[model samples]
Target: MKKLFFILLILNFAGCTSNEEVADRSQVNWQSIEKDLQSALILAEEGDTINIPGGYFKFEKSLLMDDKQNVVIAGAGMDETILSFKNQNEGAEGLKISQCKNITLVDFTVEDAAGDNIKVSDTDGITFRRLRAQWTGEVSETNGAYALYPVLCKNVLIEECIAIGSSDAGIYVGQSDSVIIRNNEAYRNVAGIESENSNFVEVYGNKAINNTGGILIFDLPGLTQYGEHIKVYDNLIQENNHRNFAPAGNIVGVVPPGTGLMILATRNVEVFNNQIIDNRTVGAAIVSYELVAAISEEEAVEADETQAGSAERINSDYELDENYNPHVGNIYFHDNNFQNSKWFATFQHDFGKLFNFKSPFNPPDIVFDGFMEAERSPAEILCIQEKQKLVFINLDAPNDLEDLNENIAPFVCD
Candidate 1:
């Protein structure tokens, strides 16, 4: 029985490996394929269905489409049809769609673009299904920023897609509305999946693993929209301890390794029923923007012994938008299974160092910065309910870490 079980396991492993391995494209008609594909894209019209057969094709310039509606770009299969941009010279994205409506891109793999692998902008009713966007080498800061990117788009649906090896976020939706990202897998990227300054977003039934941070919901400054009405649930976020490889000055460079889920300066977000497992850092971190902004200033982090008063001084450095809310509130976490195999936190980034400074052993499963609006109470800002014994901490960041405690009474709400 043991021998039979071991044989079955090896067979299953091999099958999985073959499915994920990149296809060999040693000899192919590269130039001819590129010309044909580009011609098809150019001549495509509204309600046209452009079908690409299964093969590996290399292109030097971007395949672009503009001002077309109800177009369907279909391929044989995600693993069978590959478009390589490793030698691309002309454009940033491998596939760029702009000013289109009701467009659908399905069942293809796009790899190694100069910028985002596939970027669709200023479009409505975009759908990405059974697609794979990746970089086929060692993960580095030079890799494209986002694998499957849709920005300033509406009525977006991204399902059953795979994104890998992005320097920034693998599956990124920014400044978009009415988005649904479900049943996808994101791995080996800085952030597996992220929603930035987007509204009415739903992320669930996804697997985010082997990335720096599994999932992130953020509202950064200077964007047309602020992140609100976000829901992330029923996901497998595990072992996301990959070292950060984001380029300098990128906002996500501040994200420490070993983070499972991070909610930063966002409001009206709900996270529930996730299996957050084995991340070396905190399982879930709810933080205000001030603490993140202060990490870069050596003087600010060290000048105050307690590290509580630095945010006051750091606030002077930035001129933020008048409508931008730096405070994180109206957040709820419930019925999450947070587990950690490693007890110590990461020292890769300054934010991780701050966490280690606070808890050198047995990193807290949930950490809140303890920043709140002046008129609101803790119960109104944050709420948490766990099925297991929860390890929680409040950094009391607004008070310069003066009243750091594990007290959960103030946040307990019916």
Candidate 2:
């Protein structure tokens, strides 16, 4: 039924461009737009420019580019140049660029692709500027997973872009290094901006609102890359209370609605100068991999046999890196204004099992799992100097109330 809705939704856009509009296309004399674009990409030389003239450039198939370098595909401003994939006939993405370098995809709009809107993988020195990627329809599970995705790349910069209505994440940087994503607007997605198994990145000056969660920095098991050294500051993270439409088995499936910001297993992260407000759940949470806490059935049974599932075991089958550092450390939060946030959503994964559900879910602005690497003193492991009137929880023990302390002495740091 959703697929049928997508077809009709795309048809509306396709149907809007009347025959008079089609007859007005005279910038490029091409029999097939997709083929012409493909040939242009292949024939492009080093430091060459492929300028897409101003008009509706629709495609029934994806545009695939691989092994190219020093090329730029520029269009008339994003509002003027429209690329529609309403009836995409082939491929998993609207545009897939791989094994390329110094590529720029800017000044265009890609609308209603069946899969990810733009996927750039195994490429370096990429820039996505002033572009819009969207699925124009009522928000639902049928939306694509990612709007602008860059994976396994280095030296990427994405700025001044707009993305909307992605089922999973609006802008996702995965297994990439040295990235800067700023000045982007994202909403109505499962996660607005997500960094997964990525390293050496900065995400600031972005507005993320009305999504399932905003600004998730996570390192899940079984991925080839490990996440570290990320900085998230000076962004508006608010009102991310959308429904959790993420499919099961994916690590993000555990994220409930109304999450403003969350960091799991990623180390060396700093979040400051961000306006966090009106998220119905906890404002922000930092947890270890053990707290993301994906336990297998066999492990669950063994724990149940011994003292209320309290016995710990070492499971090695699904480790990502050799060190397997599951604890979160070097996370600093300072000088941010947090307001109107509470335990906004219900929990689904191990977090629910470990947290006291009946206890006022969260009037607290910040929550932690009490599992740190102990690399620093109480002043450093997880430092928080941001002052806001809210409750704080330390779920070090599931049943012990003594372990929970309201004193702010343990968290204050410069």
Candidate 3:
């Protein structure tokens, strides 16, 4: 019988070349590979598969997988696994998964974690693939605060990830629900993909550059989930203008640094086909957590592009969430492509005054601090359509500059 079909094709090529990976061979024994990886997740079962045998690992604590269901902690990829907590002293995060269901964390890389590097809480069918979180010095306050952090999750799937140096939010999805952040690659950190108090999130083909603010959709003031249907599309968000190194009081440490796609107190957000450029100030900022909690750390470092940060000193005494609905209406900016952006937006502290008007065109690729929800209506449900050189501003509706109105016939709606 053809020698038993060549011995069953050499035992199916030796069982598909036996896979486990572990590169740069030999000489291992870090406390016996951390006591056999904490006894393989304390004796994992439900469809077990905990490979993890790549290289450098230093763990001081945190590496737990609690209440697991269909666990799968794979590695040997993200540049051949590297876990290091830079000498962590106990834990708050760095591979902490709780109440997991169909978990599948793959291709690891964590490095420098004093807190939050891969936190999955209250999970249910989670999947974070091609992971790689970092922070090798520079851009500090002791970088840590989120890098693939999934909170109160459910049906979450973050794909092809690669977040770097986060001092807060390098891909943070808090108080979650059904979310899907795709093709990620956030740089420097401090909000390069954030969706707090989450609900139905759908950030597309992400690539938020530089950092400080390239993709945020918040709804803070005590969570339990109050965020709405968010849908930012095909992103590329540019320049991001780094320099925010969060940590002084959290809430993205006062974001401002050429932002690109920010929407606080979220409510049915639906921005589309983005490309946003330069970003020296705001290429889409739309507030209302009472106008960023009433800005005042001296209005966040002057040069006031409509001052929005600095000094509520985070943890502003808690107390919020009696149903928490600080209003920010329908919001649905369309077909985006704004380039260069005023780059600074004519100072005064930085965001408003619409380039202090005096002609010279080009400003307003969306700002809207004019809070909204007096029932809301800037032409019914604010739906900007068929963009023709982005421009908009409702800083509280003060009109001038020849009453700027690029086709404002009720902002046309569906």
The best candidate by lDDT is 1
TM-score of every model versus the real structure: 0.89, 0.82, 0.35
Q: 286-349 in candidate 1: lDDT tens per residue?
A: 9887777765456434433442210012332444577878878999988889888786789886
What is candidate 2's lDDT per residue for 264-320, written digit by digit as tens? Answer: 878889999999887766678877777555444354345345421111122334454
- Model 1 earns a TM-score of 0.89
Query: How well does candidate 3 match the true structure in TM-score terms?
Result: 0.35
Ranking, TM-score, top scorer first: 1, 2, 3
The reply for model 2, stretches above 4 Å from the true place, is: 1-32, 295-317, 341-362, 374-378, 397-408
Q: 1 or 3: which has the higher lDDT?
A: 1
Give each model's whole-structure lDDT: 0.82, 0.73, 0.70
Cα shift from native, residue 139, model 3 (Å): 9.2
CA deviation > 4 Å runs, candidate 1? 1-32, 297-318
* Candidate 2 backbone clash number: 4
